[model samples]
Target: MTSENTIKNQLPDAISARVRSAKLSEGVATLVMDATGLARPQAEALEADLRGALEGAEGVSEVRVAMMADKVKRPIIAVGSGKGGVGKSTLTANLAVSLARAGYKVGVVDADIYGPSQPTLLDPSGQKPKARDKQLIAVDSEFGVKLLSTGHMIEPGKAIAWRGPMTGGALTQMMEADWGDTELLLIDLPPGTGDIQLTMIQKFKPDGAVVVSTPQDLSLIDAARAMDLFRQAHVPIIGLVENMAGYMCPHCGEISDPFGTGGAQAAAGQLEETFLGRIPLAMEIRVSSDTGQPLAAGDTPQGQAFAGIARKVSDWLKAKGSHG
Candidate 1:
């Protein structure tokens, strides 16, 4: 074969060998990995190999992994869960708020279309987003974070009936909304490892992702799946967070692991990503979230938790620089 043909033939092998499979769709070549049993070191090793291979391929305009679910303008860090109800939304809200308060222009796209929690977690009394020249304008929370959510578009009851195409379309619109000079966009993805999740990552092409889970075996298992999703999407897995890891009692001022702690941290180690931090199960976090006010907006335990996470995230981003 000619040298050009030889290069082309070698490209597919380099990519497919690193992943479970590789395919070209819509002029974009993508690599998908099962990544079921691989530990973090193995995954990273595989990713490095794949990156090197793709970097040498000719005629490859874009190479995407099958795991990123959203297409975003800025560097986006996704906060995802394997399943729902592990405080992913709460953590996302507070983290975004904390980042915004720490002098970064932050925007949050609540990609949880089926359960748009940011509307409730951000500010219940907050005004809906406005459209300028047919483009949606993200609303600003009291803490100065720009926000967009499916919650602002459809009623909660009707959102359940939205089909996959509708969800994808809405997510595209929300993600593409006018964030207005934001430095970072934190996406609060819907729970699951399904098509919706995959599509969101591919479209948004987030810079990295953070998985959130409670410290239970079941939640950790799901978090592993979530991490795998990002891995497959070829998006970098930034870290994992153990939410509701422990609880601080208000009456006696003591700590207890209602959910049995450390599972998430262990999982992150196994996966070879950084273990971001833990958020204790505090009544204050729940109350503050429910009231459309996150704990990170003020001087509270929850605020400190989010602030620390934000700092870590900002530091990491500073180190990585810009993607596009």
Candidate 2:
């Protein structure tokens, strides 16, 4: 008595929506399975489950599952800073590399129209992205990460003094790239809440945002404003990261806190937000990052710091259970 409709109703609730069509003929069951947004392992498991369920049904001798994945909507995570000097862009680069190293398919969009520094950090050679079918192509980096930045299209050291519409258009072009298999797209937003930020919220609608700030009251105040922007737009605030919390002198072995640490954590506590972690003010980190070599791509102390932060962010998003 088992038929196509019966088998579909018996399919797991997880992939029920993916059942495009099903048919049964001569004791052979055929199913059209949509695996969009599913990871490779997940797709494989789904196929097995479908086959088992169909074969176990009455009158079903063989089962065939044709798996297909439609174009998936990549989740966006916007990383913003209160002010420009809090090393937000640098953190974005390292975080992307860390996530990629952890086997996550990740890409970055340098959405900082005013000051696009990601090209220097990710692609020092100033490589330009090629276009096909009127869509931009993402440049592959050495750390197994993909990147699209306004810096790659503009001249170095030149200011991008454009109006709101121009800036929004550029951001659109960078985002419309061929980011194949990229599950997570990290947008390195420009400093503060402005037209660019508003455009992103209104158009792209990010899944969440991570605010970066230094361990100082001034920067923390700005960071609070940035978080409020995302909150107003109904975007979830993933957490806050305190950068430049401490600095150690390699020559004299002296530790210093010139920026007066813990301000960002205290701010997060007051706002009842999750305080992700901190990054130290290390000279090696600066040198390595500025030279197109992200510390998070290597096995060093600074790299571990960035990796730790990446894991927390990644886990936080995964807990939401929306993405595969």
Report the lDDT tens digits of candidate 2 across residue range 1-324.
446676678777766678887888888888899988675567888898787766767877888889988888788999998798999999999999999988888899999988888989999877899887898988888878899988898777788789889999999988877776678899999998998899999999999999999998999999999999999999999999999989998899888999998899999999999998999999988998789999998899889999999988889878987444
Clashes of each: 17, 0
Score candidate 1 by lDDT. 0.78
User: In model 1, where do residues sit more than 4 Å from their true spots?
Assistant: 1-73, 156-159
Where model 2 places Cα greater than 4 Å from the true spot, the runs are 1-69, 322-324
* Candidate 2 TM-score to native: 0.80
lDDT of 2 at 93: 96
What is the Cα-based lDDT of residue 200 in candidate 1?
Answer: 77
Candidate 1, residue 85: Cα displacement in angstroms equals 0.6
Q: Estimate each model's TM-score.
A: 0.75, 0.80
Candidate 2 achieves a global lDDT of 0.88
Worst 10 residues of 1 by lDDT: 64-73
lDDT of 1 by residue, 21-100 (tens): 56654445666654443433455666666657665466565666643212334788888999999989998888888887
